[model samples]
Target chain A: MNDVYIVSAGMTKFRKHNYDEDFRLMVKRAFDYALNDADITHKDMDGSVSAYFSDHIQGQLIAGAMTNDYIGLATKPSKRIEGGGATGGLAFQAGYEEIASGNMETCAVYGFESMSHLNTWKGNDVIALGSDSNFDYPLGGFYTAYYALMATRHMHEFGTTPEQMAMVSVKNHGNAMHNPFAQSPMKITVDDVLKSPMVATPLTMLDISLMSDGAACVILASEERAKSLCKNPVKIRAIGSSSDTMRLSDRPFGKVPLLPNESKDDYKNLKYPGVHSFRAGRIAAKMAYERANINDPLKEIDFAELYDSYTSAEIQAYEDLGFCKYGEGGKFIEKGYSEINNKLPVNPEGGLIASGHAIGATGIMQAVYAFWQLQHSVKKHLKNGKLQVENAKRGVIHSHAGTGAYETVSILER
Target chain B: MKNDVKGTEIYKTDPLIKRWDYSLSYTHSYAQDSEFFKALGRNVLLGSYCKQCNYKYGTYRKYCMYCGSETADIELPLKGKIHTFTTCYYSGEPFMNDVPYTLILVEFEGIDSLFMSRLINKNNTKISIGMGVMAKFKSLQKFDVNDVYFIPEL
Candidate 1:
């Protein structure tokens, strides 16, 4: 396989673009920055993959072909890929695979979403299409509604609180204040987060992610091609993807997936509180670290961008990513760990919780932030003033599609 | 838990026993101004089909999403099954009906046959997830496209 390196990445500041910003318009803006950043043009853009997991929400299925028309490369091959919230991340995976398999020397991956026009309450009803429609949808359940159940269950099982979840919002938004692109740029307090209206009981309005609209683009090129055009090339040390049951009910509750051990049967309680999220994220993390030849993530990776469509997701990632031990997540945030200037900084880009989320645009948005941070070409919102992953060298990007149903964790090295 | 439980039924009897339902919004599109709007005015359920993928889908689009082919316009079924369902007791026509009402995901039977619509139940029966449901037309005189609801199979 050829060495796939991310030469350039660009993202729109996540906000409620409504229908005011069309998917094509957003993708074009991000694409301009990406290509220029890569020292390439539309003609040299060997191939392209467009992803926007929301034709139902606010698109007319005009994403794939219309892009090349704008670039005047109307004849170049292009296609659309969808895999839930990880649509953006999945686009990157496609571009990377294309480059690695010698199918293309360089390719552009882009994702766009316009979520403001959507009825946010309907999110539960719609994402259910990818799920077991009969079993899951009929129960009056949804992604956030189900996630709320996870939060409540986690709180019941391990004493996790709405306040600890708030602390995460407090920290990430503070990080986003340094990031000019973050939609929810206001620095908030735990009190502010807790006081916010409850969208899903345990998940207050602040704990839930914003209905953001934005687009992101990343240029993936072979190692040889990137070194020639780019000042700093980020290597894809690891590219791993895995999935779990789309039916949330099918997953054993209260059970977490453990590392494959000598005694696989030694660990029997798979139905623990935070198992699915950890299993999805850890399996991705382990595959990434294995390729990077690093065992420890907290110390080895400089800056990390984990998918946090909700506050609970980040806490799950901390344990799943081995940033902390299982059942230590609440304490993880309680002690100021995982915040900027701590042992490890997560979501300096404000994450989905504050940055606003356009399902397909979210995961790629995470990767773009990690890319900018690693190159010291960091955006303003995530610079965190005190310690912003100082001259970060290696970074990890994770995008979880529809809870833990689909996961992609990639390691990027400068 | 007790206050949340113990459900009650609601009935409405008024001078106007039957009334027409309506839903409409205006968006400017030259392409839609011609044939599409004409269909919408006639209450024709419009959809699109892709020749390349040999798949049919609803909620019309300009391009074929699965195969990236230019699409041909088509129509969807008026009836379907309850793909999933929900009961809402907190809100909706409080004075006429309350306690609980079911909203179902109805899957139509046709070529790549699919669709989801709300179900209006007057029986107060148990609304299961995978229950068979069929469209209940309110007659063109009293009907509106958005107001079309499904009834239980039996």
Candidate 2:
């Protein structure tokens, strides 16, 4: 097996696009920008992968083929990948595998979502289709309601308060103030988030991510190729992917999947991975940590780009990633453990909450920001150094989909 | 030919975006779980029990998710407690007008899994976890999951 390195990455400003900006235009912009960032052109790429969550939102089927042709990679080896919100992260992993397997020397992964075309409510219906359509959707299983259920359960199981969840929105939205590519950056307070219009009980409109229209692209190359073609390339240290039952009800309780930093006794008598926690996230993070030889995440991993589709999910991730013990995530945040200036700055690029979640583009957007961070080029890509973690050497990018069905974690190092 | 093609609906004037409405219903089949929906019309909530693993599901399953064995249909208790729940102030197109509705995951007696259903008559009722609720079937059956809902136990 060969080593994979991210030579360059690019992301569009995540927001509601105007009438003229379709997905093709978004992909072209990110693709071209990525190539230019690496000081290379499309001619240097060997293959590609395209990602988008729904053909319904794009208003076109087989949209990946159109994007491949539009980006002038018409004859190159390319395919589309979709796993709901994990589409972009899956694409990034696919591109990494393409080079790691020696099937291609260089690969470009591009993802886009044009969700602005639909009304917000309608767009949510399309996303909710990712759930068990037969069982949940008919029972008014709106996505926010599903997260709300989990939030309520988290609160019951762990004494997690709505205020703790609100603090995550406050932190991520606050960080976005310095990130130009982020959509909704604000100096929000916990009170502001708590007072926002309730979409579901315990989750206000402010606690959720926006349905955005944007694109992101990352170019992965073999170590040999990256050393020659780029000034600074970040190593793809390890990638881990895992899944759980599609229906949340189908997930059975079991022993918590332990990371190197934890012990079985830590969660004794604890009903683990209930709706309050994500077992898939724990397994994925554990796999990545083992492969990357990371013993203690809180001490080793410099930062994290967590999938914060909802504020409560970020607190859930802190435990799943072993940054803190389960049921202590709320306290972890209250102590400012995840703040940008504190231990293990999370979502320095503002995460899905404040950065914008364009579904397929979201996971790759995390990668784009992580690549810039590891290269010590946040000032170069973001044009503002306010959100950059100091002396960052390693980071984790996580992407999640469904209620808890799919999770992908990839470690990146300088 | 040009005159014939000029009948497209204009969605927006500036960018020449055309209005293309994609509203259609799909005939979705429940396939193996057809019994569950049919049983709801009889006011029976059907779940699956794995004889091999001795695990029972609160929701219908053709196969045991844990042991991968064929599951036999089991009649689930209609009365259950709210394991967890959320009240929606917003929803999808189908349930959009039904905003402020409460959805719950109910835990049945002797069942290992939970079932999702709407909790009705929650207008003035304070819903909380461990609250006892009973299933109420629709008088007019839709043959969908919507046919059954829960109300606060009398």
Candidate 3:
């Protein structure tokens, strides 16, 4: 297979947009910025892929074709990819495949979501379409309720506290203070997070990611083309995507009940057979690390940009991604291991919490942050005297959607 | 340098707004779902039993997820234990009117899957995981899916 490299990446500041700015305008801004960053004109592109979660909100179908025409790339073989919030990551995978198959020399991938047009309640109803309509939606369960169920179970099983979950929000909000592009960079305390109005049980309003309007783009090129056109290209070391049962009830919940003070050895011996915990993330990360030749993610990977759509999801990711053992995610965050200046910094750009979740834009935005981090150009993007990791060489980006139903993990190397 | 090149132009105007009132209807015809709902209309709890995998799905499923075989509809015991639960503090419309409502995931006896239902007649009763519960059906005013509720078992 041909090697793929990201020649350039661009992202718009994540926040609600004015009525005049629609998805098309956001896409144009990101597209132009990416072109400028890559030092290439639109005429040099062979094809493009557009990622957006819903045409229901935009009032259009086959939006990828429309986006191509709107950007004056109508003649190219363009397509739309949607996997709920993982749409951007899937689009990147498509662009990589296109170039790797020798079908295209360079491909431009972009993702955007314009949800500010609808009211919060209406927007939530539209986003809830990602759930299992037959089982989950009929019960009037939205993303928060689904995630709350998981959180409740995780707490019951592992003695994870609401305080630990709130710590995640406080830490990410602090990290966002340095990210100029963040939606809201206010410093928050665990007390504030706990005191915030509860959306669902155990999930306060602060525990959730903001729903915002934004766009992000990246230009992918084959290795040969990248070597000629770019000076510091970030190679796409490996990309893996996996999915689980759409219905949360169908997901594995581990057979053996979690015991207090269960050691890693006891966990291995007493754990139920044939039960896979966090099957989606574990499988995806395993495949990605294998392909990227990564043995120990915590030791080998320098930095990470995880999809923290919720505070608890980040904790779950810490365990699911093998950064820590199962049931240790809560303690992992409480110890401040994921802080920007720690041994391993996750989500230095504030993640979806502070950066805002524009669904389609989130995954590509993560890739952009990873690219900037690996290229050592993140200092200019910092706002409040935040220091970037020193001598960073490798990073991983994870995106998940539909309560662990769809997951994508990609490894990037400088 | 800017003499020949056109500078970026900003356009300001009142945005045109279009409103679409649309509703989509579908006649869902999953054989197992139909059977399950039909039984529910009669206040009977129906489950799908996958003999191939020896797994009984409390919620109706047409196919066995583990073994990929067709499942047969079977009657399930009305009582179960609370596997997990959450009291929703807020939600979207239709459910927004019923905020602070308790939703439970009940693990029925001899079933591999858990079923979700609202706990009716909660009446300040503190609910917890592993609490015994039984399914109770609403009056047969309509054959809707929201016709069943679970109450703490006596």
Candidate 4:
């Protein structure tokens, strides 16, 4: 019933913090920056929502409560939201509800994750617990292997080459050079990605998103509150979330959920979402596009901050979000369609692959970058403004978790 | 009572951090899906079919995922083809020493879904999609999904 807008956005530089800053302090840093950016203090906030992925990583439970307290909102009505990697995105969605439902005029959404405490393998096992522990965990595969499985199938069915996947890493990592907050910025070629140490067949280390320690926060307000609090507010035009089977084995083949720009005939001969594609992503995009009144997302949306947890997943997302037809994602990247100056610039902030993925903060990080892009504050926020889309008006930010299990898509307008 | 608590080991000096080590062993019940694990010990793979809708789940399920009806356990064919596969050069703690292992999602004839398992590849054969793989079970069972794996059918 009410329009929601992002009044301010802020985040910590995404990289391994080496225990220099705990999750609580990291969140405070982001929250303080957000409050200052919005020109508002905690006294002006209504309610709060917090997100983080693993208690094991934090070495504490009820981290949301801890963060809320640390950020000076101890007595406020606050709730915690977690959907694995989508925790931050889902928290933003919840904060939107607070304003849209008239429950709160201005709400604060912050998310953080501290993953450096655990060793890489042990940390991976902790994340692997998000899978059906009873079924998939015993196989001893890390999340990368699961994604690698999908990558192989995508290549098999669509002739998606490892080179094309490598191109994604080159593009994203190269874009990160200008992003001051990015973790692993690089000026590399496809060969660099291909020659990187192999983590799984067809996927090298460079193809993966970094597991970092970071925090991000965004301030949300209703239309009236936004107009009064901030000079230029980025409207949360539309939001949508969808989910599928948690276990990858349980995803049943079904009709491809068509976006407004597509038809049934497009995928008539293809087996829909056969581990090669994500059904939840397609459905989430469809729901958001329909609500946002976007028919051709690739043409209409100025840019996107996709959840590129893996370079291959980014390609899959391009197709699922209808930027290109299914099976054409690899070709789409090959043509530089998602470059900073291309038809539809994606992940101009370097994405999770090039920027960093702090699990819980990942979704919120996307929102933060998108907010800055929409506000035309790229030069103000980052070292270079070359990543900014020319005359950018609207954009999409996506969050994903598990093996195509939980997904969220939100549309933001300037 | 005598004070017997020990101090936490200081992990880092610069950051002034303490090391906290903890482990949890959960005694979990498989509930309705216990038969699936139990069947693995007998060198059999047990999937389930919905009693109402007759939708088959290649992965064991006590209740139909689609119809929410009670499911009946059914033995699956031991031989299936690889729908997809990945060779992990790195993995979690349990499989750390067993790096460069292969994992496969096996698709069976007439089955609407796929089953996940490790591929032993005893003969060091090249694995590919649609390659035939046959189920093999461990004599000493752990009652875990790893109790059964697939080997190249040839």
TM-score of each: 0.71, 0.97, 0.92, 0.97
Rank the models by lDDT, top first.
Answer: 2, 4, 3, 1
lDDT of 1 at A116: 58
Please give the range of 10 consecutive residues that has the lowest summed lDDT in model 4 chain A: A15-24
In terms of TM-score, which candidate is stronger, 1 or 3?
3
| lDDT assessment of candidate 3 | 0.80
Worst 10 residues of 2 chain A by lDDT: A16-25
Give fnat of each prediction, in order: 0.00, 0.70, 0.42, 0.80
For model 3 chain A, give the 10-residue run with minimal summed lDDT: A269-278
> Which portions of model 4 miss their true places by more than 4 Å?
B1-11, B122-125
Residue-level lDDT for A293 in candidate 2: 96
Q: What local lDDT score does residue A275 receive in model 2, on the 0 to 100 scale?
A: 80
Off by over 4 Å in 2: B1-11
Cα lDDT tens digits for candidate 4, A6-100: 99989999996547888889999999989898799888899899999998888899989988888899899999998998888889999999999
Screening candidate 2 with a backbone cut-off below 3 angstroms (N, C-alpha, C), the clashing residue pairs are none
How close is each model in CA RMSD to the real structure?
A: 13.7, 2.4, 6.6, 2.4
User: What digit string (tens of lDDT, one per residue) describes model 1 on residues B38-137?
Assistant: 4544556556678887766544454664567887888767555554444443221211143244444454565453343456777546665456776554
